[model samples]
Target: GYSYSNTVPGPIGSILGPAKDPKANATLPFACSLCGSCTDVCPVKIDLHHQLLTWRKEIRVKGFLPVSKRISMKMMSWLMQAPRMYRFVGKMARSIVPYLPRFMLYNRMNDWGKQRELPIIPKQSFREWMKQNHDDK
Candidate 1:
């Protein structure tokens, strides 16, 4: 998985460069399960899993990550941190995703729906169910 790139240059060099070795790029770390075996086995006790996470951030900063992935992460971060927004977006997505045309949901833009059938949104959220059934009387 490692290679010396003195042979590669220019646009080719960018792909094979020391910093951007395509073989050693983001996908390896993304595939990792973070089992921490690397961290445990290192004689110097390096935080290997943490280092892998740091590498993901570096890859993201270097604009190696996909635009859609970056946007989705940002959207998730914003939505998850705000309770009302989370509830609203969750409800909205549940309502809209099912009704969306197959072309809209299964396009290249939606990587998730491209490979798999979209999830069926439930009729009621947990909060809504609990409100009706578990309300203080």
Candidate 2:
């Protein structure tokens, strides 16, 4: 066997675990969950859940994934959970973007403002949207 440089497989399990096994691929499901969260969280808004499900259908039902990509699915599940943490990260990011050289920022994130406008920070979020709406009654 050729020497594979991937780190996903441990020294115990060789370079690649079997692709279809659930235990080996945490991201396969987490990607869908992230999709759901994104659908709810998108400010300008997009239906990420449907797209994720479609991706799943295309990948699993259609058997389109290559051997290398299947095992790397564990990355998504470990990423997002707390609202405060997410907001903190957003604030940190927003604080940083203005300082970056404009060309560097533009080059790093293509279409950085092609559609999205600079966010107008609201007094509260959509959760607060309902509360404020009800309070006006």
Candidate 3:
């Protein structure tokens, strides 16, 4: 039997309900892909993705995110604010990631890459490409 209430939005919405303790359900929102599929199919025209995003913000604000994730986000924030460092890191990743062993890249520490093959790293970033192709003009 098909169960409509078992979808991503149902459980997340239930856990995020006003009477429920959102702090206890901090990890629920991150489970969504934010693809808006649930929003599209909703007969009531509920903005499910927006609700998920709001829950994510609430989780972050309440400091419920894991330490490792918080540290990584901080590091990424720092890296993005430094233009030179960002470019350097991008260059290094493009040059190095392809040659890294599969075991190293797809290990448990890399949850995003564990289940799927990573896309081929491009030789240059979009900024580099734009500079090369259009800067002369």
lDDT by candidate, in order shown: 0.66, 0.47, 0.74
Q: Is candidate 1 or 2 superior in TM-score? A: 1
By lDDT, the candidates rank as 3, 1, 2
Off by over 4 Å in 1: 1-24, 27-52, 130-137
Give a tens-digit lDDT track for model 1, residues 1-137. Answer: 33223355222232334255633454444545567776788688767677666666777877777677778879888888999988998789878778878898788886556558866679889899999999997
lDDT of 3 by residue, 1-137 (tens): 01223232463453354226665566667666788898899888888788878877878888887787778878999999999999999999999999988899998767677667998788999999999989976
Which one wins on lDDT? Answer: 3
- Tell me the lDDT of model 2 at 46: 66
Q: What TM-score, over all chains together, does every model reach?
A: 0.60, 0.32, 0.69
lDDT of 2 by residue, 106-136 (tens): 5524433654555644544555578878776
> How does residue 90 of candidate 1 score in lDDT?
77
Name the lDDT value of residue 115 in candidate 3. Answer: 66
TM-score ranking from best to worst?
Answer: 3, 1, 2
Candidate 1: residue 72 lDDT (0-100): 81
